[model samples]
Target: MSVSIIKCNSYRECRAGIDKALSLIGGIEKFVHPGDKVVIKPNLVSKKRPDSAVTTNERFVHEVIKITEAAGGVVTIAESPGGPYSAVLLKSLYRTCGMERAAEGTAAALNYDTGFTEVSYHTGHTLKSMPIIDPVLEADVIINLPKLKTHAMTSYTGAVKNLFGVIPGTHKAELHFRLNDRAAFCSMLVDLCERVKPTLNIMDAIIGMEGDGPTSGMDRHIGLVLASASPYELDLAASAVIGYAPNEVPTVREAIKRGYSPKDAAKLDVMGESIEKVRIPDFVKPESHFNLLKLIDLPPALNALVVEKLASRPKIEYDKCVSCGECARCCPPEAISMASGRPVIDKSKCIRCFCCQELCPKSAVRIKRSLLNRFMVNFLK
Candidate 1:
């Protein structure tokens, strides 16, 4: 597998940055042809501004659309918001990221409601058919433009995680509730990626999120754009730069096991800047009930039951929580309820999918880790 990287300085240079990155791997002409219906799926998880580093840089998306259109392809920008799947959010993202102006100027349309289609994947597991955004399914070529950000649940969100946007907002919560366990959830993510099978994957690493990420986190500049045909390979490369081992990341490991790509960096060819130069500081992984599963030795059946029973939904820090109800609204199982002007978690029904933590607008929800849990984690590490 080949992955290309270009050292970009700022958003103003995005067009040149994309040109340099793509040229290193073959050009837009190679991946997209004339009259092709190209869908550019950027990370528009929320309505956050570009500097927040929570979503893909609008400049990057604009550059991709510009290149595709110049190469004689019809381009359309689309995404399904994380929770509450609202056109309001989509419009807000476009406006805040300056994508609205870019789209209009480039003659590309912004689609919030493209409808849905059923796509089947032979996971050989329990899940058979999955619903995905119809525009993604029907597109002749999908240029996956994802933001390079750290995720509390997945360690890092790169090319592979971006595919999650393909699942319609209405069904995302259901999937989270169904695949509650980390391993199971990772399997579901891989299944979705397999069905979508993006033609090309590009990561906007010019500015990346760290600390409690994907949605809420601190913005740090990394100044790079990465591209590859294989999402798994791109993720592996990005994870290493963030000081994470490929095997330790559940989703990348699961993808490798499913015959996607080799998890080891030595097995793949990385083009462009040296990994040493692009590496960033390590990020903290979110707390999960599964961490306890590693400490105790129990039967698989009993272990599963224990995890289900002990898993906790996110707890709100009232002082920090704005009571925006973003956490309550995004709760996959609807386990979070606003009772007396504060968010409460229904532990019995919580799935520990971390969607609440991932989508919390205020970054108010944090995994309530006990002292024992902290000690165990330190000892294990």
Candidate 2:
């Protein structure tokens, strides 16, 4: 497999830059054929604008639609952004993420289909089958557009992680609460990628979030766009671009364990600029990540104490919290509640999925890490 990395300074130049990236990988026509139904799935995880680096850039989305149209492929932009899953909610999401404006004057249509078709995952890693939105299942080709960002749970959010958007509404939260462990949860993510099998992946790294990301974080200038046919290899390559050891991401680690990606990523024929040329030297990692725990040799009581010590728990800052109830609505296990004017987290019930942190628009939730936990995370990395 081959991956293309190009320098894309801004959205104004995204089209030419995307074209160049596609050209390096044999162009868009190679994937989109005439009369094919193309579904472009992008990261619309929240209601934030593109400049916040919380969602995929609309300019990039528009360019992909244009290319698919040029290839005579019928295009639809589909994604179940965070909120109620319905035609009404999707329509609102389309406007929030600029999907409606991006598809305007283009043959691309914005999807508001609330219907879903269940398919067997067969990966058997975590799920047997999942209900996917109709647009993805009906598409002849799927074009994945993902933003490069840090994820508190998975460590990195890139090609493989973005495909999780296909799971449709509340099922996403249910899985997060069930397989709360990063390692176990990533098995589901890998399975989703295998089942979805996108025809192509285009990464939006022109502006990426770092620190406490995928939702709340600082936007930094990454100034690049990437394309790959294999999401696994694309993630492997993206990890390098972000200056992360591929193993730092649970999805990448899981892929390596399952031989989805080889340990020697040097085997890939990387086109365009070298990773070193565009790599972020000071790129930040997620503020909190899962800890490696082994309790086989320890006493049960001691193991429980150690587990509590090593894990980073979410804490709501009384001063910063807005008491919006968004956290309560998204807490997969229903662990958070609004008390008076503050959000109180049930530490015992908290799954550490960081859904509360990710959904907190006010950035009030902080990942509270103990000193020992901090040292352990660094050592493990």
Candidate 3:
């Protein structure tokens, strides 16, 4: 339950910096044993280059692979992205980040489909068992290499959120539709994390996205690399460094309640530098209300009605939208249509999963709140 925070000033020194950070928390050998099949899960959500800050840096992935090799473990890079999960996109992302050449020269194999093996989870609720992607379930160890970035849906996307890549691309939209509420989504994220428990968690924060992130956000220089054995602990440290509270992030709060180490920062022995040393300026929370139920308690049906009416997808600026159709393609429940010039969201059918907001390439879509909604949010804060 220890987290290590390091102030990494440049990607040029990422390999050495990350090595030092991992050394503080029992080192790579402690996690990846000899002859183990280590899966390096970097944030390859899209084909965007490293400079875009949309995906984990190639150099960071290479560094982790180097460490795994040094530990006598076989390394393989893998991920499942939304909207037509293709090996081509994954390979392209790696090449953009300068990983393709390294993979070939290092003789590291890349597993795309590794196909799928169905594993069941007994939830003890309406869902008796759910099938998860196979590569994650079969790997001897997983080194979660996630980029530090803001998420329009869950507030911040860190280690735990990055594990969502294991859910497989085709099934992700369905899961979003099923777990519509923020609390429910948080629960599902923790569930997935528990199922595919990574041996190590690493955050690539040398350059991170903010404002409207995960996909379409501006990059800011935040020179640091974070490592932890516990994903929850890593997320807690990440939230703090980003000027957010553990409770403010639904996934972190839920992980803590589920007996994960989100709080108890004192129990976490930070390694390279104090969090205050690498702390970034306060990041603005996306324009959305978090604690909706706290404002008023309504019956289940009434609450559903109110939330549905209140939550509407803000209009997409066609000029700004690059006709990528990513929003239309990823909309859960198939509520977005691009039959017109650009994508048009059907509010009545929309489930408000925020998949479009997270995947939009142009940063055209945002959560628009009316004057009353803004007033209520301000008053509540």
Candidate 4:
């Protein structure tokens, strides 16, 4: 397993960077055959524009579409973003995320199909069976186009995490409710990757999000494009480039435990620019993801208790909130409810999945850690 990395300073340099990154591994022809049904799964996590670093850059996606189509592969851009997966929502998301413009001159078609098929995966540790989007289920080749970003719930979001989009619409909230434990949720992600089995993985890291992300965060320029056939290995390298220990991200740690990827990303075969050359020494991580309990060797029961009390919870910013009820609608455990045009949380039922923070359109949700957790974080540092 090898990962190819190429320096890409801007979207304008996307085509060359993508081409070279693919070439380093093998080539576009290696994965795409003539008359192949290619599904380009870009990370349109929400309706945010590409410049926000919330989704895959459209220029980067467009170049992949062009290259795939040139190789005699039929291309379709597909993604089940953060809300109800309806034709209307899909149309708005595509237009906002620049998918419409990206597919303007190319033969790539934007997917509006909300249909899904349940596939059985007995091998999955956490997920035995799940509904996958139709386009992905019917594809001959799945080109994973993911953006490198920090996630409040998962810490790092990359190739493997991108596959979470395969689960259609509100079922994602159900899964989140079922797998409230971070380890279980991450293990499910690995299982999803195994089930999807992407043909190739390409990551856009020219501008990546830091601090609270996958949506709300500041953009930091990293200027690199990365690719790998193994989604696990691709995430291993991409997460490390942004200053995370391989084990720091739960998904990468799960992959390591499963023997899907090396325990250390440094052990992987990396081409083009070395990790040290592109590594950001001070990339900000999500505060909510930091747990000091890992350092203490408490009994299982006590550990779980402390982690629950100390874990970060979502707080609604009343000033920033538009009272849109988005947070209440997306809450996995139904812990949130709209009262007098404002959201009220039932702390007893809260699961800390941060779905409200993730799917909130107004960016009104914030991660709030307990006072003891804050002290522990600073003390540990």
Best by TM-score: 4
- Model 1: lDDT to the true structure: 0.78
How far in Å is the alpha carbon of 273 misplaced in model 1? Answer: 1.3
Candidate 2: tens digits of C-alpha lDDT, residues 196-275: 89999999989988888888778988898999998988888887888877666788878888898877456657899888
Q: How does model 4 fare in lDDT?
A: 0.91
Residue 255, model 2: Cα distance from true site in angstroms: 1.1
What tens digits encode model 3's per-residue C-alpha lDDT throughout 128-164? 3455566677789999999998887888999999988
lDDT of 4 at 133: 98
TM per candidate: 0.91, 0.94, 0.91, 0.98
lDDT values of the candidates?
Answer: 0.78, 0.85, 0.78, 0.91
How many backbone clashes can be found in candidate 4?
0
lDDT of 3: 0.78
How do the residues 214-300 of candidate 4 rate in per-residue lDDT, one tens digit apiece?
788889998999999999999999999988888689999999999999989789999999998889989998878785536669888
lDDT of 1 by residue, 135-159 (tens): 8887999999988877767767888
Best by lDDT: 4
Using TM-score as the measure, name the better of candidate 3 and candidate 4. Answer: 4
